[model samples]
Target: MLLVLSEQEKTSFTFLTSLPEQVYPDLVKTALSQLLSTKQITKVVNSAAAKLKVEVASLTNSSLYVLSQCLLNSAKRNLTPEDLTSSLKACGVEVTIVTPLVISYTENRDILIDIITRSTVQAPEYRSMEWRLECQVGSRSLHNTVIPNVLTKWKISDPRFNNLKTKETYLNCDVNTLQHITESLRAAQLELDTLHARKMCRNLARIG
Candidate 1:
């Protein structure tokens, strides 16, 4: 799939294309390496400025940020090197400039994809639920009085943690409150099954 570039991204690509063709591999390598390690690209930018005898602001503003973003998005979407090259070319980048980027992508494809997959947020899932009915037959001041309540326990699991983390919650409510809670949950479930939600899921699937 072709990448759609914003106006600012177009400017970034233009800046990259204007640089000496020989610098392409090292520049793309620095960008991808720093990104893979979750480090800032400031050093690379500063070095590039010194080598090119240009202001750091020019490179920072027109290039590095967008370059990192492009690399991250490409990895996140698991784009093939050829697809990435085509997309960059479509953005007006020269074949020479695109070559290094594709090479970096090809070399680091597995690691990049693995990191992106691991970093994706997975929603907490229901594990178990227990509930009991409680009745209060009398109060200290009043005799012959009766009240009923529901006591509920819920457990949820979050997969993001190194260990499978679990959370527990306790709730006490009257019949009306319990009914309201049940109806609210049912409504939420219905919402998820709606056409709009299905469309959104499709869109997200395409993106990921």
Candidate 2:
């Protein structure tokens, strides 16, 4: 069945869906559960070598995955699923999700370690720092960061984030509530990015 959603809803859905279940299988379920503590989301814990490697580097490696929705809807870009997906891989971010999607995390001993061993980062800092998102979707280690400010801005809630609702409102977030927070974040961030881009354009125009 087709589901109707706000631009943000769709954006968050696509991003969370593409991520590895190991990190946030119960993303929807857990988002409902106090929005996944920011503390848990930011640091990797009790993970094997592979899971540890991937989650640590999610931001730089998977900008497209994280930004695909915003780029498509807010920036009015015509990025295809393949395009964004490929861009993510090319950037060295890992992505995986099993069928019959889970709302909570499960054991994933089978999660490939090939990506972790074979992946190459261009810089020392990128090599050491991790890239895990709250949801543990596609992740990567960046050789050189091109967008630090924008990257920080992209990360809204938590690494364990399948949803972005504040916790005071509910014990765990439901799909309905998840959708609400996603839209709110998207609207605010898209506008911020648009303005940031516009100012850069104006500055360039003046320089020329």
Candidate 3:
């Protein structure tokens, strides 16, 4: 899979989002990282953001572009943001940005050098019934980007090896778009303590 949100894209997206310039990069980077955790790879993989590694054509000119060629090339590789985020978590990546649940994949692999969303898996929350908050998120985006060069890594054909629904319960959005959470894991807004994005950018200029 190819990811578009570059280290620089994070910078630009931050500008667009109109978030504090100082803190925007962190937020954008965090948003991009989510894709790595909480996304699915179609027929080959299940919707469990357990682990994700993406490839990109290049990160040039303070801009970023990504091209994700589908591995399975499933006839219907339509994935939701929730599906992607959950899968990323199952592997190890954490997603916490405003989840953009919809992404498109190609049947054939190609080099995509365009801006792409950085997927993320949200920190787990408690169901409204159980009601807990141990899973509160810290970073703006779920991805860390501490490890670069996400491509060149091989993935399992199917993580499940076999698709089995141990607990059978129809999802709220199996057909239409819907993001559901078990009554046990509902949440209020996450409280993030951080610096401002705009200020940080200015600081970089001062140092440079």
* Top candidate, metric lDDT: 1
Q: Is candidate 2 or candidate 3 better by lDDT?
A: 2
Question: What is the lDDT of every predicted structure here?
Answer: 0.79, 0.35, 0.28
Which regions in candidate 2 have their CA more than 4 angstroms from the true location?
1-21, 28-75, 97-199, 202-208
Per-model tally of clashing residue pairs: 0, 21, 54
Write down the RMSD of all candidates, one decimal each: 5.1, 25.6, 24.7
lDDT (Cα, tens digit) per residue for candidate 2, span 1-208: 1112344444444555555656543332322222223344332222322443545344322422333222222112233444444544443333553121211222111121222223323221111222322322333774443422111112233323323321221133444565687899999778767978789877664322
- Flag clash pairs in model 1: none
Listed in order, each prediction's TM-score against the native is 0.63, 0.20, 0.18
Once fitted onto the true fold, the runs of candidate 3 whose alpha carbons sit more than 4 angstroms away are 1-76, 97-208
Candidate 3 C-alpha lDDT tens digits along 43-63:
222111122222221221121
Residue range with the least summed lDDT across 10 consecutive positions in model 3:
66-75
Best by TM-score: 1
**Candidate 1 lDDT over residue span 33-124, tens digit each:** 66677667677778888998778987666666676677778888778887898888887877887777788778888888787778877777
lDDT agreement of model 3 with the native? 0.28
The number of residue pairs in model 3 that clash at the backbone is 54
lDDT of 2: 0.35
